[model samples]
Target: MLEEIFREYDIRGIYERDLNETSVKAIGLNLGREMLKRGAKNVSVGYDARLSAEDIFGWLVSGLNAAGIDVFDIGLLPTPVGYFSVFNDKFDANIMITGSHNPKEYNGFKITIFKDSYFGADLQKLKDEAVSTIKAKTQIKDDFRAIKFDIASEYKKFIIYQFAHLKNMKLKIVMDCANGAVGAVLPEICKSLNLDAEILYPNPDGNFPNHHPDPSEEKNLKDIKEALKGEFEIGFGFDGDGDRIAVLTKNRNIKGDELAYLYSLVMKNPRVLGEVKCSQNMYDEIDKNGGKSFMGKTGHSNIKKAMKELNIDMAAEVSGHIFFKERYFGFDDALYAMFRVLELVQKGINLDAELEKLPKVFSTDEIKVETSESKKFKIIEALKLELAKGVKELPEVKEIIDIDGVRVRFEDGWALVRASNTTPVIVTRFEAKSEELVKKLQSIFMNLLDSIKKGM
Candidate 1:
């Protein structure tokens, strides 16, 4: 029932403490009422491999039925399959019950209304209603009134058919599912396509017995990287809900922005979008190739919104949320991204060689500065004002992009400082043409941020 559970992206928190049966039911009721206000009648619902998912699903369905909304249960599946239901089956809305790469103890909902992300202010309003209007004494029983829907098989069939050309192509690939929801469908699709693939942790285990389901951290990719040392020519790692992907070659871990750059090479006048944390080389490379590139706010929902608003062909986040509007739905799908990577390889594009062709730049991974949720955005605002006054130790600022956070552009590179919308931290990254400059930028930015935090 805590207000902090309602994040900018979706409703998420520790399963029992913040998202209990009472609170989840309230959320479902409020969400259903909101949909009713928008004239939405029925919704498709799916849950991930979390242990608490089934219990939460029943509570949610009870509340949704109370609001006179019909539910189509898609059962255990990846988050993207829930999204697919809306596009393919023409549902009014969809809700995926997933923690999405968070710890095993966490669980929540990712909602899509009319094919658009139901997030940000809309989610905040639902929080207000759910907390204030609903009382504990309100007798809401666990009356599950959901009809069964088999969207998983349809989704797998769609993928296998789309990638039929790559069937038996003699490509040795390694995949690490991390015991997440992707295991529900990916292995079967690979087998159907006759792909010579080795899938690690292909069973859906809510306990996450192997490792954390997140692929963004290099530590989590240890097994896949080790497997690639022998016969595996390429490797892929997927997050819990199967919406984010980490692609690897023998020599390099191709980031989402880099993947966007690679995908653009095959398109005619490709218009691509990247988040604020993306390296400058990604933008520069796309422009150099006679394509257009743009920078937008970070987060999967924000990226998808920008893609649709700009009619972009593709979009990517540095953390591996890649969306394609060129040939498929404009939603982040790690499963689809894997096939796209295979398509690039099949077309004779050398993944590592294409990456090597780009201009070299030194960059640091996302550096998180721990701060209270109440103070994170304040720190960002204070730092922005301080930089506007011109810090003596920092380099001359060429431009300041504040679309999501403050990305201060310099002559050689840039430094980004943004407050994470989902967690209580400020995310920072630095990129420069040389290692020395990268260090200098990081040091200066950290000092400035420290000063601002102290002042606050």
Candidate 2:
């Protein structure tokens, strides 16, 4: 059941079947056993606002307790809260029960050991170890420490204190929770700051009846934008797990890189890291502002890990996984991100003005081409080889950057082909300083990818 359900980034499956009690329990036991071996005694657990979370939490804790591991229950939180629990307490291991932006019927896990992401390869290793020990059922503890602790208060207080001047900022704001987990803390944070705001879908419900919980998709944000009625200066939307976020102004929808440029302005020499998927304008803007910018791989875990190594103040993905090592914990928190934007507003700066100043470029919003899960990575390997041959055989290419996947930069534009780490798709994006040039680049890349699909 575990193997069949495992995805590249997280484990997810249908409840009561693919994610049955026995398999999930065994997963918990294996995870707990691994944590113990790694010298972790106390571990923190949190869950999203899913209907299945209550039962999943119970079964998951039961298995962990069976392995003689101590568990801290952080009830009904965004995925980021589980990360916060690791830093807030002395504990080193954390587990978040969530399927992130997937459908409401879906649910799964995002885990970390000693504040490091237990992702991708590590996740598979855990499943493999559990499967190898099919008979490894330890004694289940009669009672475990399932305590309710309030973390939002301190998190709210920290941001409020950080932006103390925003107490009476007197700016109208609109937030679209999309019926996800962000509903728990954002309103409290906004209220504490005395920031006037209207919230849509503030109640934490798993069904997500108002709209799909993904904010990155433009169509999904229609209700939230319409709700604003051009009365609010800023808007925020969060995915189901709350790790990913999106921003909206009256005129335009701001991407993560745009937020980074606007947010980093208040600081002096702020070092920022961005993913390979970010628009070139974001990197150029950071450089122009006397700040440092590093283009790295995409993934919250990867971006967060890169921040520590690079000692960067902030990091963002095109999909809006914003991390702030500036004034708070170096994790992606949408509630905190909203306050940061409010703080920017309080300073009398325009939200879209910063983006407006940047040199305009035409870019794609992450085009995904579906491939067989087994063939996707191997096809990426084949594509990489093909790129190497094309560069050597063709004269049009100026440079190729294969740090994550492959990015070919021509004189007029650039095109990227990368396999998404989380899902079964080869992600592609194109950009150019001119709209017409961008369209040309897109056509070229699309034709090539189409031919590749046919050949494969």
Candidate 3:
């Protein structure tokens, strides 16, 4: 097994080649042993719609059983529901086997222990254990005390009951499940609410025969945009495991920070947390409305953890990961966020009009620069050092926020360059008051980054 599979967030890799039976089994064994050491007796396990999910599940269970832990299988479900099972069903720990928005060949686990997500340093420890040790060849017993639980149905019922006020909405809505695990619960919730909606790719197909599960890319949103032209008033798209969302109208493709601003209007004394990649307008808008805004590091885990610590009402990333601690749980859930957005429509708020009211600014979507995994972080460090030394070719900088990556604040705008923890790429984004300034800022950074990489 390759060490690269052990990432900052979770364990992810190509099936069989990197995460073979032995590696996965060793992972389960190590995790089970760790959980048992923490006094965990029962653990909830769920998988996404990936083709190799079941086979991996079987192997993982064997290791868990070898470590003497009981597995409560929730079968196929979204990542949020698997997280919800820990709180609602009182499971000691939960593991969701999903790839989030990655391609079909990728699969990983998002682990939760006693309501706190097991990530960062905890994941690193698990990786150390899994990699250093060898798998035992002894034949383990079958029937690893697996119990089937219906978390999906229960989760669906909870959502429907929570948003019962939205029942029988007259708005024409469209949903694209992307043939991922959202198919399991989205239709049921919408149906029970009597929503006038059309569901696309409602079946959980591992092949993803329709389009790629990631909604962040413009190409993946073609189907939903087509349905929105004349028939549907609004459209919602979900990622593979259904934690992130993409909201689209006929005139605009709403982003996460924009959604945060819209949601803040309905909140009382709201306190929202946004990542560094979020636009300054979002922070300025929240401040204008007598609400507090805090900028934190990127990533769902980082955002969620900061929210709880600060007692923030909501948190959002530019990539459509919305977390609400105002009324619901503190984790990111696309279905839950969908209901919140729909509630705005139920209140007669025009989606496009409300967005247009915000201060206009030019922003670029996340642009990735290819680099080796070994050099990604080094490049960021090099850029930061160069910025500190004050290069002549670069634009005048107000300040630099090095929380997640290097976010250089120019007098008129800001540019960000960060190392992607999950991929071998440097993610960069820029925002400015004008389109011309935006391009100039981007070019300056691109040239500086190129020069730095060449020297390295």
Candidate 4:
């Protein structure tokens, strides 16, 4: 029973090792009890392509049933589909069993209740309850069976209708499903809309034999790039649970913030929200286009909450998590975002050309420094203290945003260093007007982080 599995964003850990039957059943029972306390009577459950997903579902349902919570099983589907079921079916709660972009040995649960993601304090409470139950050695007996329901077709139909204008766009499209949850729905949806797309790894393989399910890594995108080089005008890649997306032009990979910028061009008075990690150009461009722009804390849960509270039309993270509330539900759906991107191209908006038009700035991909989960946050705090002490010696700080992590703003660019909530590492990113400036900022921050971690 590793308590560390209960993460900030979701409950995740190595399968069998940390997410054994005992821990998982405890999680399910605690979650069910918590949902009931929140006035939730029923929950729609789903899983990704992982082989253990079905087994985990069985164990999870037992715990839920023991707590007298009705379970509506959507079987194997993307995480977003579980979110979709909650809205379209009016389910009181929803849970998606997925590892997301993590490796094969990892698995976890993403939970939602009353339209709000069950995270942060909710997760902490659940963890505490589960640990208490285990300590008390409570035996929960299963009482009810799960009811099977299919939401894939309905979700696909809804997406097709939402973006019907993109039907038969005749653009050569290539998609890499990465053998994740997208295999079951993405192809059929594309076919229904008459999209000329070539799908790679359309089959759902939990092993992910072709490549890793995460498309954010450049190495995992090699297949998609290969296909793009051979007659594909555009490429799309999805994470393990089909929530995050990686958009690719023939020549370049389009990032989430850039995608928001492109989407804003077609929208009338768009209100876009981006994470602190987003580029300054995205914020400036949205404001320049008569739209509202806001920078919020990084993380899907944080972005979603801000979007709902502020009535934001769209939100994005630099890591390719794009949420749309303009004409669709306010959730990060890669499949839906793909259509929006195609809609831009279908409506004569040049994909690459539009991106090229944005002010050019050099940026680094998310750089991770390995550290223990226990030490990661401590390192960040130490670095923060050091930065404050050395403020006079460092480059002039225009502004420092500590919404999620520490984002130091310089006149020319900015640098961010934060502890990754999902992994045992410190995530960092830097951007500046020139490559040299970006490197300089990153070096200073890296040195600070290294010294702090060593001290710890």
Write down the RMSD of all candidates, one decimal each.
1.0, 2.3, 1.4, 1.3
Better of 2 and 4 by lDDT: 4
Candidate 3 per-residue C-alpha lDDT over 1-456 given as tens digits, one digit per residue, 9 for 90 to 100: 467888877788999898777788878888999999998898999999999898889888877888888899999999999989987855899989898899899998888888777889988889878776553454444435679888888899889989999999899999999999999999888889999999999899999999999999989999999998888999999999999999999999999999999999889979999998899999999999989999999887787789889999999999999999988888999999999999998898888998888878999999899999999999999998888888786668888899999998887889999999899999999999899999988898899889988898
TM-score of each predicted structure versus truth: 0.98, 0.94, 0.97, 0.98
- The TM-score measured for candidate 4 stands at 0.98
lDDT of each: 0.91, 0.80, 0.89, 0.88
For model 4 the local lDDT of residue 449 reads: 83
Please give, for residues 371-397, the per-residue lDDT of candidate 2 as tens digits.
Answer: 877777777777777776673423388
Off by over 4 Å in 4: 142-144, 391-393
In model 3, which regions exceed 4 Å deviation? 135-144
Any runs in candidate 1 off by more than 4 Å, and if so which?
135-137
TM for candidate 2 is 0.94
Q: Rank the candidates by lDDT, best first.
A: 1, 3, 4, 2
Instruction: Provide the lDDT at 26 for model 4.
Output: 84
Q: Which ten residues in a row have the lowest lDDT in candidate 2?
A: 137-146
- For model 3, the run of ten residues with the poorest summed lDDT: 135-144
